[model samples]
Target: MPHSNSPMTEVLVAADCWRNEPDAEAVIQRAITAAAGNVDADVAGADLAIMLTDDAGIRTLNGNWRGIDKPTNVLSFPALQPTGARSDDDAPHMLGDIAIAYETMRREADDEGKPFDHHLSHLAVHGFLHLIGYDHESDADAGAMEALEQEILAQLGIPDPYGNREGMD
Candidate 1:
């Protein structure tokens, strides 16, 4: 049974490419649970969405939202909330939405010699952290965010994703 405070995760398959990994939804859910549980704030009972999209889908989003015009591994779109509680008490708090590109993730995993699930978990954790206001805009912030990602993935028995990068250790 899930804890009453556990955040709710909704996984949507926006592309057929995700069918290559039938366990994508479960992997994402596990990663999100681990991440939300370890975060400093109380994100319990919150609701978040994960879109398993393909390169073309992510490219459109990147072009529209980030103006990058290229497909990335994952993108996090956090919901904006006010300073006060919601007027509707019964509604769950909206955390944010995360979209992951299937082809990019697969290629990255293959290149890194990591299992597909492990890479998926890492991406999900990274996106969840972004939704919670953790960013890598500066060196200090990147270090902090990456450290937290390492810790969370470690809990899932995933080897350090950043270990291969020089000076990231």
Candidate 2:
């Protein structure tokens, strides 16, 4: 949060199905900002993208990138640089790109008995953590990441997303 600002996040709605959540962009922005602050990551002037797409759109990305054939709720593609200094260059250093699936996220929200925005916020925060090098690939790593996610979301008035569940994909 250099200059007391978060990353320059671009929320792109690439699918018509995402229209179902008119506040998707706002929710994602808020969640990402909060996550950056909580993690003390100085991402100001860094560029990131949040793609709001449907299952099919995300599936293609997953297949191409992760060698997976199915869609997931959220996927984060972290760039080479985590954050960068203010520069006069035309493009700021990229932090990462996060893609979220509308149908999958909606289904998860309903199935988990959580509000759509709550689930959305969690996913956004989770993805942001990944962009900043947080991961749950191991038991200890998962605990630390999950704990931070809970703290960040709680500050946004969102309940503990892992209260009733074992984990998220």
The residue-by-residue lDDT of candidate 2 on 1-169, one tens digit each, is 2235588899999999988789988888889888878876778778999999999999999999999999999999999853545458557778889999999999999999999999999999999999989999999999999999999999999999989867654
Using TM-score, give the best candidate's number: 1
Cα lDDT of model 1 overall? 0.90
Candidate 1 shows a clash count of 0
Clashing pairs in 2: 1-42
- The lDDT of each candidate is 0.90, 0.90
Q: For candidate 1, lDDT tens digit of each residue in 1-169?
A: 4544557899999999888888999889888888877888778878899999999999999999998999999999999876865666657788989999999999999998999999999999999999999999999999999989999899889998998976643
| Runs with alpha carbons beyond 4 Å of true place in candidate 1 | 1-5, 87-90, 167-169
TM-score computed on alpha carbons, candidate 1: 0.94
Clashes of 2: 1
How do all models score by TM-score?
0.94, 0.91
Cα RMSDs, all models: 1.5, 3.2
lDDT of 1 at 50: 94
lDDT of 2: 0.90
